[model samples]
Target chain A: MIEVQNISFAYKKRTPVLKDFSLSIAPGGIYGLLGRNGAGKSTLLYLIAGLLKPDDGKVLFNGVDTRLRKPSSVSDIFIVPEEFDLPSISLKKYLSLNSRFYPNFSEEDLHRHLDTFELTPDLNLGALSMGQKKKAFMCFALACNTPLLLLDEPTNGLDIPGKSRFRKFIVSSMNDERTILISTHQVRDIDRILDYIIITETNRVLFDQPVSKILSRLKFMTTDKQQLIEDALYSQPSVGGANIILPNTDDIDTELNLESLFEFALVNPQALIDAFTNNINA
Target chain B: MIDNRFRISRTFDLFRLYIIENRKFLLICAAAIVGILICVAISIASDVSYKRAYSMYRPDLDPAIPYLVPTYIIIGYIFAALGASFMFSELKSKQGRIRTLMVPANSSEKLISRMLVYVVLYTVFYVLAICIAEFFRDIYLMAKMTVAPVTPLYTIFGNEAAINFLTTDKYPILLPCILFVGVFAIQSFFVLGSTLWYKYSSVKTFALFFALFFFYTISVFMLGSSLSEGKTYNNLDHFMSNYFGYVFLCFEIIVCLFNWCMAWWRLRETDVITTKR
Candidate 1:
């Protein structure tokens, strides 16, 4: 489990990016952390990874303070940043250097991931295209088998086929113990895979809930009726009608439209929070 | 939970990774060292041949042996400085900064592992390079001696004159070791500077170090002048030789240790955004 307790952080001499923000992530399943630009999404991820220390409060991974960046915590976590550079060395050499750090690293898993990506370990990482390099790194990260995997914009450079392959690989690579947190603006890339969603805005968590719970509580619908659109908690016009979100008054399972849901949460965060809170109390 | 302290196995693992990533750079350094050694050997041999041919008539040819060892030591120091300056070079780059920080080891382990490679390992290589250069110099001298009567290779190459000059220390090894420490202490300062400043760290360090060095030198001179009043140059020389040298050595060690510790602390504070005040 990862617990962030009222962590506040900012770049020196700059305004605070995250102020007294808190969240917890339990093990298992994929989590999609969505936020507007400059909403502290990457900052939060860095704080959790122990890459940047919070100015106040703490981040704990399995009861260990992540700020310490101890071997136990670091070894069980791997982060793939949006942009990275690989050394001018063979993929095999790159893996040899990095793999030993992860005690659970699997050579067979690495080979499998590479094969899935149509990459061979013999290729020089520096020579590969950016997308290919990303795939190779993703392959290595998966092979590490760490309990927590943090991926920032993992699909940024991937082609359509590569993105599909990435989705497939992520699903196949997941285990019950692993908790994968993906932070990306490209919600469509990972909308189906995310079991949980976190939305942040203006240095605070606007929403944090499981997809199943969210789907059960909110009725996502497309309506042409002006009365229904105005009465809705959040609504947006579509081609033939308007996509709207309302309280699941009848407790029907509505198919989630993630883009619409994101817009709804941002526009009507208080209403969404109130509905969940009222439901919990009742 | 995680062990925050050092572990030998993990340190080795970190070191191994460092070597793998930097193997290309190390190879290039090795090739450059060898090339330098060969060049020095050829130059020294040519000089020896020229001296041997002219000495019979001129008879005033200065023996190069007395100066060669010290010259090679100076060369070794230059290479050591170059190698150490890039110790934290990766931290300057955007991708490398993130990757290095994200490597699954504590900051101390990471620092120590790199210190071992940058300082200790580089020192070992420097010593080996000196030894290899000495061997080439000896071989050239030996080939020269076959045709003409020259200074014995053993006396010159085995550090006879240099050792004899420092015989006051009893252990001849102490002098070279002391010299190594002095050079390493200065180089370690550059290592710290490289870690702290991102762009042209070595040049910046060089400037800062020399400026301070000159300031210290002037302060010491002025203080000595004030204290001596009407003393002779010989009296001041004696005081400087007996006391100032030891004080300077102590000062160097302190500066080296202080800067190295500061570098470690700075690394702990370092993050992806280096522009942060």
Candidate 2:
């Protein structure tokens, strides 16, 4: 549903942020976007959201130029940025303001989502705590019901319960007509709901695969005896032993470690790709 | 057509958003205006009238002044406050509020919608305050009737329909609203300057304004005309000289439009959230 073809962007005189970056994200699935501190994850998201126009190349939504920011293009795109500011208006008013923008915004859905987050619609948003405010926005974005939802570091302020609620809400709140892309350094928060993982590095996508497929091809483990697998691409020491990830030569049952995969993918870029070379389409 | 469904009718929606977003601020401004006018009205009743416009401000004025100074000042303050709030809130709520801008809505609709609300609300309160001020004039005249014997209606409004027309003029509301639009548009340049900086966009706003104004003034004295034209133009007469005020107002509109274009471009260029990294 979203396409980025060799797009490049920079901030004023700074170096190129996204250097010929390219990726294609389809609809009806939740995708986890992973990257390092300066991985241009947020920039990529903003470009797709039509919040920022790319300097070189193009970003298209359903073959429509995102740069134009026409209503047809933007109405279907919504970005829940990392740090969104709320007005000093009541929850009822906030919903009233946003509902008019998106035809799909369901007031009933709004009430339900707000209820799940324990956010009172009658109360002023300013009166809510930080976590509460974030939850309120989460609810609002869900109610916006746009076809594509882009979230950047959405799990930042959530406590234990809130994080779990976020997972539940994502899986249930949206429809099959929608495509959801979430970018963050805190991968584990959204690890469960992410059906696909797209690892970003060097201004381009390094890895893109479904979690089920990614799991079947690689194994993540922690060893205290410092034992290393023969095909291990990268490893790090643990409290008792070490954390290791290896290419799954056989159909061995192993759980996926998003953090381990991100780290291994970073340190052993060639090895990770080479291991999956023959298995790209899988 | 699908365009009809997704029409730029969002201006009305935005007005609703603007009001709720700034309800408290509106309340505070309204209270301050009414409170001062009421105090002046009381003083006028006590037989103390004709206070110089600048030396002291009474609750009301001699209903006979050429232009209603207090009314204009109060309305000016309202427009300035609304415009400032409109731009600041948009900046303040970037991730939150900026998201709204991306909707298939028209930029002019969003802007004019807030302005429409500002105009309507400002006029309502302005007229109410003046009527209250006129009411005070009637009370004083009634007391003076013991010796002078004057009627209330003729003195208070001068002419009922003219007062009615002035009270509801397209000009009174439009002009002050337009003036505030200029001030707001000019102020937004400061905001755009601030967003370009880091945390101190506020202090940077002032610093940048002075630095640029100084740069322009010096350059004018040395080279010539981007920020400094001359000491010749101060008020409307100087600024508009010979041509209709509408012509000059149109030029001001262009300047406001320039400020708006720069604002939108600056926002898109930075991709602000990227700075979080």
Candidate 3:
């Protein structure tokens, strides 16, 4: 588990990226952290991973300050930055050198993850394409078996199949003892795989809810009926109809449309908050 | 209670990782050192041959003897300084900084591992390269000379300054200790600078060092002149003559420790994203 307590951070000579922001993530479940460009999604991930220190307050992992970067704390956390470099060495050599730091590293899990991504253990990382390198790095990251995994733009450079394999990789690696917070704007690539959805903006979290609760509170549908559009909480035009979010008054369940939900949260944040708050009251 | 912050096993792991990551660069440095030494040897051989053909040739004259030690010391210092300054070159880029900081080793382990590679191991490699280069130089000289020289190869370890310092100095062991600490202090300064400024670290460190040294020299000169103005004491002269080595050694040791500590602190505070402190 991780706790962000009233933390504020800014780059040199710039406005604060995150101002008095706070977030708590419990163990287990895949979290989809959604935000637009420059929305501080990656900054939040870095702060949680202890790659950046907060100007005020602190981020604690299991009661230990992450900024301290104590071995005991860092060993339990793994981060895959949006852009990274893999050493120009064979996969086996790289694993042999790096895996000893993580006590829970599993070679078996590594092989399985690599298989899911259709990669081999004998890979010469330098010879691989950028996409392949990302896959290889992700496989190793999952195999580290860290309790907290913070991924920034996990599917950024992936091809279509690579993205599909990435989703499978995440699902296969998921367990009750692990928490994976994926920060990405490529919503469709990860929306279906997320257990919880969190939409954030510059200094605030607009919405945070489990997928089941989101479904229970709002209905997502594409309809041509003008009446539904007028009454809809949020609506976006589609080819044949308009995609709309409505209060689930009929008690019917629909698949969560993450794209529409994210748009709704940003456009009418108050309505989104009221929808969830009214349901909790009821 | 065991201190988990400085685990020997983790430090060794990090050391091994650094070695593997930079093995290619190490190999290239070794090759380049050997190549430069051989070229210097070849130039010396050519000059000896020219002397034999055009003027007086003495079988007792060995031209390479004088250049060996100075060459080793000069090249070794430059290489060591440059290597020390580049110890944290990975921190120059955002991606590199992220990868380095995210590795599950403590700052102590990381800094120690880098010191092992760039300082200790590099010195050993440089010495070995000098020996190997000397061997090749001797072979080339023997083939070029009509008369075989009395001394074939000058031993790098048996250099005159080292021998004289060890055998003739009043405090033989203390002099070497001072020299060792002085070397470490210089290297630590470069390492500290590397952490302070990731880009163009070596050049910046050299400029800063010269500036500080200039100011320090002036300050010491003025202070010494004022302090000694009213006093022409034989006691001061005798005390300085007797205790100067010890004082210099202590100063070097303190400088070395301070630089290392500051470097480690800077490394500990490094963030993947550069921001104002």
TM-score top scorer = 3
Q: Write the per-residue lDDT of candidate 2 for residues A142-192, one digit (tens) a residue.
A: 888888898999999889999988888898885778889999988888887
Best by lDDT: 3
lDDT of all predictions: 0.80, 0.67, 0.83
Per-residue lDDT tens digits for candidate 1, residues A1-282, read 999999988775468899999999999999999998999888888899888878899999999898777778888889999999888888888877788788899999988998888888798987989999999999999999999999999999999989988988899899999999999999988888889999999679999999999988888899899998998878999986999988788888888888888887798788888878887324
In model 2, the Cα lDDT at residue A33 comes to 92
Interface RMSD, prediction 1:
2.1
User: Where does candidate 1 chain B have its weakest 10-residue lDDT segment?
Assistant: B147-156
Candidate 1 residue B112 Cα shift, in angstroms, is 2.5
The stretch of ten residues in a row with the least summed lDDT in candidate 3 chain B is B50-59
State residue A100's C-alpha deviation in candidate 3, in Å.
Answer: 0.6
Ranking by lDDT: 3, 1, 2
- Which 10 consecutive residues of model 2 chain A have the lowest summed lDDT? A224-233
- Of 1 and 2, the candidate ahead on lDDT is 1
TM-score of the second chain, cand. 2 = 0.51
What docking grade does candidate 2 earn? acceptable
